[model samples]
Target: DAGVTQSPTHLIKTRGQQVTLRCSPKSGHDTVSWYQQALGQGPQFIFQYYEEEERQRGNFPDRFSGHQFPNYSSELNVNALLLGDSALYLCASSLALELRGYTFGSGTRLTVV
Candidate 1:
């Protein structure tokens, strides 16, 4: 019954550093998607995972990656972080790829100094 949950609700990093953010999908959800939301902007899809494989990806570079476990939990990793990468990383879960059924987490706010 719990909603999607993301760890390290807030983080501060420096350029060139790498960061890994985690998320646990809601009960009965099998798909996990990651999004990046900059200040005053809408969420930008990063990628989506289902059945432990990446099913779809956004316009982000290869440095942005993700994984979905058997338990439906997921992780988002950004390598060689840039100051422009600072934003709210959101995790959304759903029974499938249906956007209407997605449930989002509060998101992990990343600040690159």
Candidate 2:
């Protein structure tokens, strides 16, 4: 089965706008995690979703939101985009939140103008 998959490999948005990023988990994964990677920096966790609920979150602002479906796919929604929000957003999937089995996608590169 395929690993995690993300949509719109790249996109550009204007400030104050909102964007929604999509993710599809691996065949057997039941959890999805999202992260943001700025230039020259490692990915910073945004949040994780399991059983359609937010299981955990990082230090990101409330402007960052997400939802997991019954089929294990997920979406990350960012509102009121700012220049600082321009970054690579990653999607990782794991079985039951196991870190060791995380399979990540290439990520969606979002550039806020």
Candidate 3:
């Protein structure tokens, strides 16, 4: 079975531009979540989507948003990107009823210059 997949493994954007990262969940998975990892820090939860609705969100600003489609695929969008926003964006997928573990994608590395 295929695992989570993220598009455009790497991206470069300006300080004020917007960026959208895409993710397709693993087979048989119904929940999708997003995280941000800086150079040295561990992944920080950005938000989670279940049943096509955002179920939980972290401390990120309003500029960060996400969407989960009926097919269980997802997208993460960041508006007015800042240099500080540069990080590895990870997508994780798991069955909502069986939340023992998650399968994560390699991640999309975003660079703001």
Candidate 4:
């Protein structure tokens, strides 16, 4: 089965632009988490979603936003992008309260010029 799926594996945008990254969770999973991974660094939690609501968030600014659909798919939206926003955006899926582990997608590589 498809663990998770993210579109536009690679993307290029200019500063001040906005981008939306999409993710489809694995079958039977009701929770989704978004992460940002920079070069030479570990992934940083961005947010988590369950029941189409944002249940938790990290230290990111308001420019980072997300939405989870009833189908358990999700989207990460970044507005007024900055160069620092360039990174590997990861999408992970899991069952709420299960907590065993999460299935991650290949990720989308966003580059801000």
**Candidate 4 regions with alpha-carbon error over 4 angstroms:** none
TM-score between candidate 3 and the true structure: 0.98
Q: Which of the two candidates, 2 or 3, achieves a greater TM-score against the reference?
A: 3
Model 3 Cα displacement at 1 (Å)?
2.2
TM-score of every candidate: 0.96, 0.97, 0.98, 0.98
Give me the overall lDDT of model 3. Answer: 0.96
Count of clashing residue pairs in every prediction = 0, 0, 0, 0
| lDDT computed for candidate 2 | 0.95
Decreasing lDDT order of the candidates: 3, 4, 2, 1
lDDT string, candidate 1, 1-113, tens digits: 66888999999999999999999999888999999999999999999999999999999999998888889899999999999999999999998847558899999999999
Best by lDDT: 3
Each candidate's lDDT (Cα)? 0.94, 0.95, 0.96, 0.95
For residues 1-113, write the lDDT of model 3, one tens digit per residue: 66899998999999999999999999999999999999999999999999999999999999999999999999999999999999999999999997658999999999999
Candidate 2 RMSD computed on C-alpha atoms after optimal superposition onto the true structure: 0.9
Question: Which lDDT tens digits does candidate 2 get at residues 37-64?
Answer: 9999999999999999998999999999
- State in Å the error of residue 99, model 1: 4.7
1 versus 4: better TM-score goes to: 4
Q: What's model 2's lDDT at 11?
A: 92
Q: Model 3 Cα displacement at 96 (Å)? A: 0.6
